[model samples]
Target: MLSLRVPLAVALLALGRARVVAQTTVKTVDLGYATYQTDASIVDGVTSFLGIRFAAPPTGDQRFRAPQPPATIYGIQNATVQPDECMQSAVGNATTPFRLSKRTAFVQNEDCLFINVHVPADLDLTSNASLPVIAWIHGGGYAGGSNGQNPAQTLVSNSNNTVISVQMQYRLGPFGFLAGETVAKDGVLNAGLLDQQFALQWVQDHISKFGGDPSQVTIYGESAGAGSVLQHIVAHGGNTQPPLFRAAMMDSPFLPFQYEYNDPMNEVIFANLSQMVGCPISNASLDCLRSVNASELNQMGQVIALDNLFGVFTFVPVVDGDLIVERPTVTLRKNQTNSDVTLIMTNSHEGDVFVDAAALVATNSTLAEYVANLFPRMNDSSIQQAVALYSNLTDVSAPTVPEQAAFVMGDSIFVCPAFYTLDAFPADSNWKGEFAIPPGTHGSELAYLFADAVPGLTFNNSAFISSFQSGFFSTAIALNPNTHGADDLKPDWPTFKQTGKTMLFNETTTGEPEVMTIPTSDALLERCAFWLSLSDVNAQ
Candidate 1:
């Protein structure tokens, strides 16, 4: 999930009002309950219907429960503005990464279950031919993110009217992922994930109305959102067929062991939050939590900040043994993943977003404290072993203690687990991973893909990457199904099974992307072996 606000330098560029003219054509789409007025992206040849509700508000008695679809609409509903973001703590400049001159308007509310749709105007609107769809799930550690942050308008426009895109909003923070014995007995863990599944069901049922192919939907997300895609693949023991999505792309999936509600560590998080909000520690605690003010609950959630070593999110999706029936790796190894084709991508400096010089200095001075933070369950001997294995003096690639720690954290939580996830697929399945070289921070690629989001911003691949990304999306989703293998000009992206080969997205001095292939490294293999040995390390 993106925590970086559009910098103040580009605030003026983002403030331009959309010019609506009387002569412009007005398009309307009717779902069973509501009719929507589609807004045209004048410069991009795209029409969009924003703020379409996919599920009923998780409000009132419905709070903390699985989402239900909104009831029928009484009349034509205007869908100009998308819904407010799901509830989250304010991201004050003090906590934000960038130093901005202006504060972003941080608006959030409970009635936030909605979806935004964008369609290419050049598609054959008169015929019944439905266009392929890309359903984008935003990531903010599953604790704080909104679909409103990166609108699909730029992505659709960049695809040259050949693709249709959808962005959705769901419950966030404690409201979405609080788990414990009381909470689990009465309600579900990972309601936010269930919310996403329901949204996909909505797309399957209603996307055809807006010229989108229900059978051709591709689910894609970044960060925690990418984990959501992976979860869906292994959902329900991975036996279910005719998946909601035909394919998937995971951008930096963060896979930690999903905990059972009864685990001591998991219970403590819930129990502490319940007590902080004045809830009784009995079976009634879940009910007591329901009665608390939504704002108060959101505020209390801030007490749980990013853990030092593992970057554990306090309230996150857990292993409930139902929706997420087994460990992701377990189900994945059993060949339970749903998508026919999968793509996983990550950058070289993912740790740059979360780890810094301050963290490094702190680790260097207090190595034991750092070890305890990352491995609370370990014994003195085990902690010492861990510190030794992760120590910079022992590892030359990252010669400093801080850099070594960052490398271990990133590889353990993200990079290696991604490798494990790919290798877990059936030997015959189609899957690939890409490593974006330096300058490609966490979600920095978005600036190139959706330059419209932050006006005046640019990247080396800004001129051609959009087309390349769109072509890749087309090949994956079958938007131009016939042209995939036949397109000679496109890069021959090899499958991982063949040679353990990975496509390197390198940023060169010249303003262009240089794609190369390199055999998967032995160092990554060795690092992943170490991390996988501690797969159940109780990260959060």
Candidate 2:
């Protein structure tokens, strides 16, 4: 009988024990909401807290509005199983990447505003552990993605229980970013961003219960998530009233084109979505939109997103005066970003996923056609010049039109904009940015950070590269992202302002880590300069 007793935690869970013992329960100060333990106790001493509510379910009349604090629940509730991801359309077919396909099944319903917290089991919340926190936002082009898709278990383990991590799901696609005058007057613009903001508020109020320091919170994101972090830095004219997080880290922070409030194109897309769902245009248009089924709204959103070829998203954040005051580029130029933020921004073959994954080009004609469609302002002469630049830079070993196009796309959409934005920071501000090597495609770094790297996959790298990349994050959490941590951690990674230096994270083999210093090169800075010199053209 003694030998038959399983692990104590498992036995208790199997026996349906629900008691709120001090060792087994985590409590939130929100009206005494208690969360029960899980059997996910790994050998590394990490504890997983899955599916904790950060906001009230955005359903019924609450739909399309700013998030509200979650309703208080009494007694110990089970937080063992992952919660439903916010509603999203099924993605990628047989040809789609496995990384994306694995995430589709977890998406469930509208009431998906949930947060997952990962803490070391030995952490004593009652003591002054005051662990640094990393609030991660996942990347999915703002149209699709869920917190359930990326677990923080590996990240916590990799950090050696040195830090606490949090990831939360906000509204996606139409539900998160359907901006029009009709919706704006009735509610807020950029509800998805607001969802993130509210989650941070929740963290500020409750992270201490898990041994995390609210004041030491650092917001980090990749791709669209990185874009969201940049937005927070520039939100409300960069005020960050009440102070959400102290520092930020953005990986591949892509700023897609956004229209200045109520651009006719924005209204056109909103009207199209409304008609698709039989939401008649009227004074009560927002109400009509609310009445439609969640699945119907998501289905229509996917259709519009699929129809587009260029980077034009069917649903994305816009320059509403309230939440986002102006174009991010414009804000950056004016030095309107929050100065309080010490930032680390980076990109990995930023355009590889955008161009290579799409199978976008096969010949010169196709490449030219793609460029013209993406940047309509460029005439035949300008397009020809751009083509010449990319053609000359194509890798000799793997020379292909598509691969060449990927290089071009990387510069245009990812690399160039970073330099342009960094220029916006004051010369004294502590900011650093870099480019990763060994074919750092979009969303590639995530594979290493999450320990989800798959062999034979395009983004997979040497183990040394993975461990080295992971250090940037752990160091950031232990110290500040701007320091990037440790004088001897890697060589000396300098800040962007100091000597205009950017450290490159590269490795020669699976066992050898190489740290090299290189200036920020957009590959085609001259070309980017030319494009930037142009006045706003109706690229549409």
Which candidate number has the best lDDT? 1
Task: Write one digit per residue (lDDT tens) for candidate 1, span 423-488.
Answer: 766544444545454555667656555655644244544534543464346545562312433432
User: On residues 1-540, what C-alpha lDDT tens digit does candidate 2 reach at each position?
Assistant: 011322224311111122221234343323255554454442246666666788898988888899998776666555554567676643223222322222334436789888878888777656767887889897777876776555555566677787788898888888888878888887667989999999999889888878888988888887778778878878887776788887667777766667764888778878888888898865345888888899888887776666565444557778888778877766666776663445555655666656533545323346676677667566888778777776677322326566666666666656666666666666654555554556666765565666542232333444544435554564456443333334433555455666677766665666345566676555555656755554254220
The C-alpha stretches of model 1 lying farther than 4 A from their native spots are 1-24, 40-43, 89-104, 123-126, 306-310, 366-371, 378-397, 426-429, 433-437, 451-458, 462-471, 479-490, 509-512
Best candidate, TM-score-wise? 1
TM-score of 1: 0.87
State TM-scores per candidate: 0.87, 0.84
lDDT of 1 at 529: 78
For candidate 1, the lDDT comes to: 0.67
